[model samples]
Target: MTLPPELSPEHWITHVFSAKAARQGGVIRRNLRDIERYVGRSAFEDELKRRGYHAVENAGQLIIFCNQEPIRLIL
Candidate 1:
């Protein structure tokens, strides 16, 4: 799957969980701000929805979770 050239790391979305950052049960979000600022909230939400992922905005950042099983988070 090829992505648009503008969607490189610098302007990419993230969905990796860090065990070390986990507390109780959830992982810490270190890149939320970067993702929100880089991708822009509206575009990010649209992409997630188009890709079949559920999106929520919390703390002014986008949170995406796969709606289908066998979670696959793509951008």
Candidate 2:
């Protein structure tokens, strides 16, 4: 289901992060610009920390890992 566009950035992100897909250890990708524009960098980072999740930025996208697991670089 798609969320209405009228929701605030924080609300939107919260819903996405709490969705079934996310809860099942799925990864969610979002546009970096949209996040920075609506939530601000610091606020976004704080939310991630509060949720005990991990995120990475790549190619102008923010990739969020829903579970609280140590992230390792394989490259």
Candidate 3:
């Protein structure tokens, strides 16, 4: 289900990065521009660090891995 467009990035991220979601090996994909505009790059990185999660960007899409495991990119 799509979230309401009016939802703030902070609230959206909070929901996507929940402990339950993380435990289930959840992955979230978001628009890079929206994230950078609403959350700021530094704050987003800090949040990832605090949660021990990881993320990567490609083609204007930000993909977050809600786990602390090492990520390998297979091309």
Give the distance in Å from residue 19's predicted Cα in candidate 3 to where it truly belongs.
Answer: 9.8
Instruction: State in Å the error of residue 38, model 3.
Output: 1.8
Count of residue pairs whose backbone atoms collide, per candidate: 0, 0, 0
Candidate 2 lDDT tens digits, 24-67: 99888888887776677788889889989999999999899988
Residue 22 local lDDT, model 3: 66
lDDT of each: 0.49, 0.83, 0.80
Best by lDDT: 2
- TM-score of each model, paired residue for residue: 0.42, 0.79, 0.72
> How does candidate 1 score on lDDT?
0.49
Ranking by lDDT: 2, 3, 1
Clashing pairs in 2: none
Between candidates 1 and 3, name the one with more favorable TM-score. 3
Task: Judge candidate 1 at residue 17 and give its lDDT.
Answer: 26
Clashing residue pairs for model 3: none
Q: Which stretches of candidate 3 lie over 4 Å from their true place?
A: 1-12, 19-23
Q: Model 3 TM-score? A: 0.72
lDDT score, residue 57, model 3? 92
| Each candidate: RMSD | 9.9, 2.0, 2.7
